[model samples]
Target: MISRMFSRFNISIGSVTHQIFKKPTSLSRSVIARKFCNEIARPENFATAGTMNDVHIKMMERIGLEPGYSPIPRSREHLIQYQPSSADLPPRSMADSFTSAVIPLSSSKSLQDLYVSYLGHVRFGRLMQDMDLFAVWVCHQHVNIPNLDKNIHLPYTFVTIMVDKIDFTDFSPKGTSDIRLSGHVSWVGKSSMEIVVWLEQEFEGTYKKITRALFLMAARNATNTGPAPVNQISPGNEHEQNILIGGEERKKRRIDHQKMSLLKVVPSNYEQSIMHDIFTRITRKDTIQLDKRVLPANGKWMADCSIMNTIPCFPEHRNAHNKVFGGFIMKIALENSWVCAYLHAKSRPKLETISDISFEKPVDVSSFLQMNAYVTYTEMNFMVVMVVADVLNPTGGRMTSNVLYYVWKCNESVPEVIPGSYHEMMWYLMGRRKLNYALGLTSGV
Candidate 1:
């Protein structure tokens, strides 16, 4: 039965692609194949492995043991040093960390019900959550610490620092085919790893690409107290070497972008001119009066296109480290931004791309999370929405947790968004930069 299931799948690692027809004699040798049997066939097991703690608990349960029934001491004192050098661990190949999972939406009614949206299209936000989880799992596969007992829990904790980008194609799933999630650890730094994951759906006996995502993750100690060292990546072939080079370029771009942030530096001459043009179009020059700005025809004020939502971070949404799951926060932010775009366009919007998402801080599990979404920039049918997530404290103070940017495309052209204040204009410029990046344009209004 396992062999029959394996015959229908194709796995790609770097530039190499192969089909596995024979089932592995041992489950440890083929984690993806085992995942196909345990997770694709039974979606309930996928839900059980949502977090690392859950994964460990489920494994214990599979061995006919109760929860917290560990024979070895799961303490920090008994194990090796908390911080291991890179030399202490062996370098891993890109294929060594490659992993894949299947969401059989076509065969499983329950999965379809969970992933399909009201418009009969698969929910992109839910897929973002899955991608985030899959990236972490791939990193775990790459990391191998030395002198650590197998019976005890892993001493390293992987946390997502940022998502470099998520680019989507025109292919949309109709809930009639199985979706495959595959990725590998493409690059590794001293303590950080770059994971490249892609999504595809089975179509006419072939897999059609849906989207690709790049995630940056950092390793921390078991208690989430400090940085932990991770294994290095050994590029085995030319294709893998190119992937490593791309990762280096991405890291460089991120640094350059930070150096040019609006918060630190003034806007460029071109950006300032664009802002001036919008100001002149909306303001009356004849009067020397305050508040002379008036909304132009076919224009919507940036502040007016705002949407807000508040959610309580429950324990169920916490990750293995008892902090709010980064994926949950991403899903919420995307949904909020989608609503903002929908209201601004007065039509259902299709997500074109999600720009770089940086997790500023981890939210407490019991905190109240608030999200503010604003349509900051628009060009014809494309709208750039920014979602700001903050954790609200009991004393009425809030700390920024995340700032996400998304680009949405409507069926028809939408009204232009005009910035009224200086801060709004900054947001407008930032939104334009993000939209340009998403659209693969170097410069644009």
Candidate 2:
């Protein structure tokens, strides 16, 4: 029955062999790919604004730092050669990178106020920001740069390239239970590492699983100039070895999925048939005019179901390198997408999965960030929301910085979303592919 449901999508589920990397004699394909992507997808450089307001002052005070304090290092006197070889670094075990932190939501009312939504439930979007931060911390734990400055930031900067997947089993979090976040580096290539994080809540002296996230991060030079080599990791035991293997499979799947993107390839016969069926149901046979189309009883036009927001990127949300944090951008995007899903579903939707989020460019502080989110597709109780974030310039130009995709499930069935144009139809198909991969109906393209 499950297979039949996905037959029209032309999807097949399967697995491939895991490729483990030993100490490399030369640069690997992954490293070369990363370099090529970075060259073409370089972020626009914006001069840092010196404007400081009352809000900025307060934030600085709260963090026990002065307004003039910059997290960026003042000097590179601690000399280290650029682009170190991967084989030069020593191998570390997964256990060496394991890190954990507890959010004392149950004990601190002040903290709870920041995390709890008006609906009296923990905000999943805020949790996503924390998870992203935690994933970077885990990567730091795995990195062992010899003789680097201990007081200053590491000679390398770890940035999130992709959020492969975030799956939620239990979205509800009680205010009385403390939330714990833990993870380790599951896989490593020369210039990339995969960090797997777990979100759990305490109940009756036990930790119950809530969700698991896989983050793919790439290392760059401290100056944000180019790709930097990362240390290699070896599995310590059987379970850890299994995790390493899984990471390899995910990497392969990501490559395959990109190659099969709708922009790069035409739709298959099965997908075309499905799209035709949708068109037939929405249009009247008596007329050829698109204006004469009639929507299904519970259908909504995709164009009418969108939401947009403009936000000022402040320095308070900036990372150590002084750029707006990727995690902060993610939190903002998720909340906007969640609201779009709610309006489309006519009910509070639960986040089922974050299939993929790509950070194409770095967002600078003191810039205006704009986000547009809309419901692209729906099936039964599931909704696929896409959020596109761009940086706005004073000249009225826009540069796309990030694209995020989310899968949400509601308690009841949602209104079917109908595509009104060719672009929207492509978005519909892309959403379907994301949903299929998230539900394990497909092994990915």
Candidate 3:
């Protein structure tokens, strides 16, 4: 069954363009942090806006600074270099190169629409959207040079290339007040940077970590046409060095995974494979029907447990370059997957991992999108949800645009799912791979 599924998909290995990323070799933390703060410090005093109103004053304040104080170092005379020195800093410890924003979840309906799950806990998709948004904000803060014309901010355009290890160790209850998002450049490459964002809840004047995500975003040309150079991030501590190494490892792992997925190895040729027994059992039974899909012993099937949602590519969901937002697409896909998981479990299922979301092309705000999701795989209490997004054309046609897969950890209330067709089986195997990689059962960066 596994071999057949692999062959039916016609998977092939391909080469990816490789580039060498450079990192600072040696430097002390204080020196590097000092140089970094000086290089990227806000040129004009935030208080320059005279007679600031409540909102304006609030915007001018930095999270960790003293009241009314900004992130700009008290003095720049200590700096000797014009750019980042050879050291790394955590997103929060980036001196002045950080961005923070807070979103108050005051409305129940809006929370339900974006973050609430069938089980009433905040869904994972909402965090993914905020992670992407906050990563972009951090990237802009890091790379946006002061334009000669102050009114025209020439910020570097960016799109999320990948997000890895989004750990949801702490759950956010549905009615939790407001969450603060802070992010900064943790690693930098020639044309890419790793933005680490943390989602936290404030309680009695203290912040508690809810989730943290590592977003690998690539800088694009001012016109948003192709990859462009980005300022390198200097690591300033052991923690920062670890993050840079991790980012490097993840980049390599992503490339290797892409290659492995395309590898043309025949699964049936390996008799010693872990899946060999199952494959043999399924193939040897000639009397058993294979043409018809099989239902689980409990009679659970795809059609009975799936979700279909239709939404427009709203203008507010557009990226800086005016295309439909990738984060928005991910948000919808996550919601659909959550609904599908709920239908199968008959209760709320916790998100294990968002394995993958591949965008075939950028979507336009003018189009109507149809999102279809299904419980593609289930075993014990493990479930995998797949969401396929398509653009509805005016000529009665549909164009596939995005494919998202999520691995969920459900409670005992969730029932098992049975694959009914070769097509369904393919998704099942793919979903299994996703779950395995997410759990570190299989190698992923």
> Against the true structure, what is each candidate's TM-score?
0.83, 0.83, 0.71
Task: Summarize candidate 1's per-residue lDDT along 1-445 as a digit string, tens digits.
Answer: 2233225335232211233334334433223322321211111112222333343354333222343323342445422364567778998877777767777787778788978988688888888887887888777778876666556666666789999767788888767578888778877888899888778889899888888888999988765677888888887665566677667766777888998999889988756766667777777878877478878888888989999999888766666545788988999899899989999999998899898899999987879999999999887688999999989998878999999999999988888888889999999999988877776543222
Residue-level error in angstroms, candidate 3, position 299 = 5.4
> Which is better, 2 or 3, measured by lDDT?
2
What TM-score quantifies how close candidate 1 is to the native fold? 0.83
Q: List the global CA lDDT of all models.
A: 0.75, 0.75, 0.60
Kindly list the per-residue Cα lDDT of model 3 for residues 379-402, writing each as its tens digit.
557788989999998789998888
Off by over 4 Å in 1: 1-83, 443-445
The worst-scoring run of ten residues by lDDT in candidate 1 lies at 36-45
TM-score of 3: 0.71
Error of 3 at 277 (Å): 5.9
Off by over 4 Å in 2: 1-84, 149-153
